[model samples]
Target chain A: MSPKGKTRIRRFSPVQRLFHVLLMLSFLTQGATGLSRMYIETSWGKGLASVFGGYESCLTIHKYVGIFMICWFLIHGLYLFFKIDWRQFPRSLFGPDSLLPRFEDLGQAIQHVAWMLGIDRLLRLDRWGFLKKLDDFLLRITRLPPLNRVSYLKEFDGLLSVITKPPRFDRWGYWEKFDYWAVFWGIPLLGVTGLIMAFPLFSTRFIPGWGLNVVFWVHRIESILAMCHVFIIHFFIAHLRRHSFPMDRAMFEGSVDLAAARHEKPAWIARLEQTGKLESQLVAEATPGLRALFYIFGYAAIAVGAFLLIGGLVNSPSITW
Target chain B: MKEAVTRVRLVYIGGAVGLLIGLAVILTVPVRLARGQEEVTSKIYRYRERVATGYYEGYEVSPRRARAILETPGIKRGLFPYGSSSAMVRIRARLPDSHKGLKFYYRNTCIECHPEQARNIHSVRAGITCRQCHGPEPIPAINHYYSAMNTIRRHSYVCAKCHEGATAAFASFYVHEPPAASLETRESFPALFYTYWGMLLLLVGTLAFFIPHSVMVGLRELSEHLSFSVPHTLMVGLRDVFKKLVFFMSHSFLAGFRKFSQKLSFFKPQNFLAGYRKLFKKKEAFKNETDNAP
Candidate 1:
């Protein structure tokens, strides 16, 4: 069969797919319940609290769901460690296969922003009005590093570029790497501080001064960052991207449609075919039932998440009590 | 590439705008104002003057209330033992005074709104016992925090709310002169007004703006790229620090048993020599027994 045909390309395996599904459910639950607890004074919060059987039970749900998510991550990490050969582990910082990020990505990001701001127009130089030219000049001046480019991240152009780019991934893009690793950063920060808040009296007994109080704020602040980053930013990128609108079922079905695989991970696909490992990389298509399940859950989550964020923002979610 | 970047640029523009808006809001808006902050410095000065002049003399304890308060055990045997700061303040207010003594007493959060007053009170009263300074009279008042009748804090009735029972638990401590006495004479405390505003800006700036993006991202980048990690290092260090703290706190009584425990060393030369000598004697005895048997 020609590789151009609609051959299913295995993306996430069964374990990985299960992990993703479980993670989605648990994370969504945790985010919802946690926010409700914080903003318990709001009407939605009051409704949610009652729906979850009041404040204490809502708290219980958030805690256990968080623990479950952590466990799922640990399982996924351990599986990857044991299942992959140590030599084949993704280690390079920047390459065709690596997510370590490359200078090219930095350049792509800068180019992308320039195009967005219409600075990259070919014929705009002579047509430039005074203010437009001033704007261009200002942008250029602000773009310069404070010092003679002694640092890769100086003026954080690299970081800004990285932040701006959606994970229009081939192999793994910058944002994909961030998505993969951010949990590693967020989990401990969230978990320990969360646990501290979870068992405040016990923690206060052992920890001194305003330690538990600090933990309380840290937990709230970090959780808000994590939750917002996931619900708003990651949602837009992963599910609502131009190419993957409505939803991305790549994670749920454990495979991407052949064209998607070719578009996004073209190099991976080509390498697999060249090495005669394409068959090994192929997987059965998601059944109608599974597809239905994916959509049902995915769209439901999207709706709930959207509702929570939009309503919370507009209403200024708060707890009076 | 241009199209891809244009799309990317849209995303960037959106995020940047969001960040800027959050920053602007955080910087421009103050998160909180002191409870009763007003532009009436003269009112505060007038109130302080009334406090200094000693508005009314209601220290005389009646036999009836003294008996009642004495039986309560928690109430101290002193002036106003049977009543709270609110009651005494109300009494002072009702007293015939040319000043607004009653209005000041019933007024909500004069000191509460004054960050300068709050800060001064905190510093001056840090290690001092509240009872020693305010005298162990009425056990302050059980202040209801929410929905005050007139003020933000029910405890705004008097200084005794914080100071009265603060030192009751401690047996040996000297009370510094009340902060108002020394602090009222100085004019520099109002400089703390700016400090309060600065704090509001900082809190909003960090939590609402800076921490939301810059600090969070900086921390993330630092953790991933840089070898230094806040969580990794803080957790391990905290655990060790806790263990050491617990050990010392638990062993405080055992200090008498080993007066120089901190200086005592298990790696002493005498101890090592004793063990070495014992081993040497046992080896010699074993060798002689083996030779005899052969």
Candidate 2:
């Protein structure tokens, strides 16, 4: 229950974590440079362009960053595929070992809903008693005008229950699979469009003028989507949700202990217990120095992303150097 | 285990084969371009040329892609790159009387054959048009007129024509200069197609994977009580649909189809993938042990 007795287990390797840091930086750089060019009329865009030494320099930066993004994405992918054990490959997808969705995830999802609704506790109540009366009273109160003001809290809490609740990740649940595959899937799109946009002259030579226009829209929309997704959705899931707000430098600190693992990834912990690998996988608590670094890097990135998102939406005119 | 290996190989090979087939198709079958030349003018969707009619300030619009300065409302035309949208403040001030004009709306009514129809103002030259600035300059007889990049003496005069026109002067609306048209006509087609479709497929795949979970998560009211269930989300949805299908199959007037259902079930990957054997066999073994219990 306390921090002292908590056990630690490794998630991402050093190489993987390093790649992630590089990825985050490259993506952020690419996004900043690209957006500046996209909305040069706006302050943020103009500021970025100026900071990077004008539009041409920004373009040069964007092109190089894009290439770095593509190269690293490839290296990460190849690293993954290089170690794919043919025998265990099947499990690597839908099995307990992989991030891919599987049938077991379905069971986990339903169970999570039960946990979310506190239905296990609810089920212990009698049908036509005080609990039902309480339920009826609450439901009726929801219809009243005065009480309706606070009734939104009920619905909001229901939604937050899903977000705030610790996920019991059995191996790789659908949500984790989603996050993993988001990078897996997004790399190609970000890479391909970034490449084309980088070499517009080379690309336009073969494609129709209007076709380039199409790529232009796709690239623009996709970039915005990626930015918004990372800023809002991914950030919320990874860091800002109730249990893990301000920072969740699990990536930086490098592991989750047995106590944290039991709550967050119960199925994984259970499997570890079943397989008798619990004590072996235990990592020591993180150093205060590393924790400080996580705060510096993690919170800094989150703050930067949030600022960019807000500034872009508001069309801030003075958002630059 | 074998299934995973087969599936991985299938995916890699399938991807390669798909790419090769797509390339072959694009190469062998020439691009059937609309060229925006064929007569698309109609009575319902009238194609009125805005500049030619000289109602430049009003509703007199045109359908010509090559020479069209502005387009008429309710018309299905290839050109109309100027997204037809303007800021509300700017509109309420300058185009107040002309603001009620319907031509600003996009008509995806004929978008399938005419995909360029899907493009709105935001897409074209930062959502403004040549006519909006230069005032209905004639489309040059040659596409090469605008083909040369950096060849033309740069001027803010064209920009001032619109941005500084009788309306308000925008803070800034600078855009990147277009690349040389020679390069555009040659290299752009494949590059555009690849990036556009590639991202589109990735988006679609993400959605396909995401939606089932979202939908299942949405059914929390039911799942909360039904703690032990077969599956959640897509699998459950599919099961419900399959149940209905089976029910209909058995009840329908055609009796032969009922017998075919069991035979057809064997072809389904889900039969094994669901790990039903784990559920049933475990249950049976549990039952046998319980029967042996005193």
Candidate 3:
């Protein structure tokens, strides 16, 4: 079939899809239940508690959700080890293809924001543009080493030479590297602290009262950061960024429209064109059933959250040590 | 790609090995520590028994009663034997309404043994004995029966008398310190006030703001990206809804009040004034533009 006329909708591998689904569920449960516990005196807390049967029940759900989230984190790390190209990972850090902030990126950010507010005309930038650059920076700073190291560049280069002939590498195509490390470190901080709070046995055994208090502080702060980042930053980039607004299916379909690939990720587009597998037309179609399900779940979550807030405020139960 | 694969495999193996070792240590360490704790606890129990018996012998009360007295609640086994005895005596006093107010004879026997403690027992008259309260005759059957019941009855009240007043037993035992105020007292009000404020802050942060904010943000994002297939979109949407609901519930009263106030005509005037000012300014700008155009 000719690439210009064909519709290509390649689905994500089952494992990847499963991981994404599980991650979304776990994060939602954790954020909701955790907020409820923290604000036990609020009406929302009470309502949430009522829906979950009681305060203890909501807490139990939150605890298990945290565990599941950590499990997903570990699984993701393992998957990265098996699937990712480590040689390409390190080289993408410092090269122009890297997501590391460039002098122009700062100016681009200002311009983008101005455009969003209708102050300036939009500028056509690279695939992972200014906003993505910021996201990459934040993810990099947040992550620990091994996943975010330039030290591996030499080894990666040596390996690359042995495997295949050299080709021009994108200076900024470091999504896999950034995403892998973000998951790696983010999970441990969230998971370890969450486990400590959920199961006092571990906290009591290894940590004293002061240590537990420190964990509480860190966990609470980290949760705030995670929620804010996911809600504002991740949401803006994944769905609200320029033409990608409304929805983007690259994560699920593992393919982009040739136009989107050409504009946003020219390197990937060129590769696709060379391979003669580029999808020409992009259709923005959402199944009715899927859309309905989204609305149902969305409204349901809001209703439950409101209930917890009310319950927490009205019946502020005394916490006995 | 091959090197990437190798590195990836190494991480997997390392992670698996680390997890296995951690799991093994977590599982085995607790059991070993518990066994050690069991041995230590047994030794401590034996030592406590010996100390308790020696302390009980020092008191003038019957050895049997002394052993039984500490078993009651609120009486620490070794620290206060006389207080324990007094508790037993008070319970015996309260039992029978028919018996003309029972007299507790603390002076004669207690004073003879411990002169210092005798000086503090002002409630007791100069001359009294165990028989004074127990009816002065050694009826073996009644004595034995009353002895068992007295330990149970006097346990709380006798402890209270010395532990209650300006010069309570507990006060005297320490350096005559005043008892701390109860939760309802003026002294406790500050703590309660702070607790209330702390709870208020927590409520505002978690329920009123954070949960709702999370849900709203999540839902708004989910709405924008509605193309993701079933379960994925549904899951994110559900989470968003939950957070919003929690936020609303947390701040219902505040929300209701805000809405009520916003609806009033008095509050509406400010908005009207602002709008009129903007309209007037726009008219003046238009006039300037027309004048300049000519």
Weakest 10 consecutive residues of candidate 1 chain A by summed lDDT:
A204-213
Which 10 consecutive positions of candidate 2 chain A have the poorest summed lDDT? A200-209
Q: What would the TM-scores of all predictions be? A: 0.48, 0.53, 0.40
lDDT of 1 by residue, A172-200 (tens): 64456667666777787778877766754
Docking class of predicted structure 1: incorrect
List DockQ for all candidates.
Answer: 0.01, 0.05, 0.03
lDDT of 2: 0.56
- Candidate 2 per-residue C-alpha lDDT over A117-188 given as tens digits, one digit per residue, 9 for 90 to 100: 555444344443644465567677665454564565456446644544444677565676767777776678
Q: TM-scores for chain A, candidates in order?
A: 0.75, 0.80, 0.61
DockQ of 2: 0.05
Off by over 4 Å in 1: A1-6, A88-108, A111-169, A317-321, B1-294
Question: What are the per-residue Cα lDDT tens digits for candidate 3 across A1-321?
Answer: 434433333434568767865766677677677765665445555565576666678878887777778777877769867765577764443334333433434344343233333322112222337434644665677774555444444464454333332122232333333343445556798788778756543343333222334455456655655555455444444554433444555554443444444444455546646766544433343456765665455445445444434443345453210
In candidate 3, how many Å is residue A302 off?
8.5
Best candidate, lDDT:
2
User: What does candidate 3's lDDT look like per residue over B80-161, in tens digits?
Assistant: 4456567565333334332223355332453463443322112232223433333333212222323322322222223333
Best by DockQ: 2
Off by over 4 Å in 2: A1-6, A110-168, A316-321, B1-294
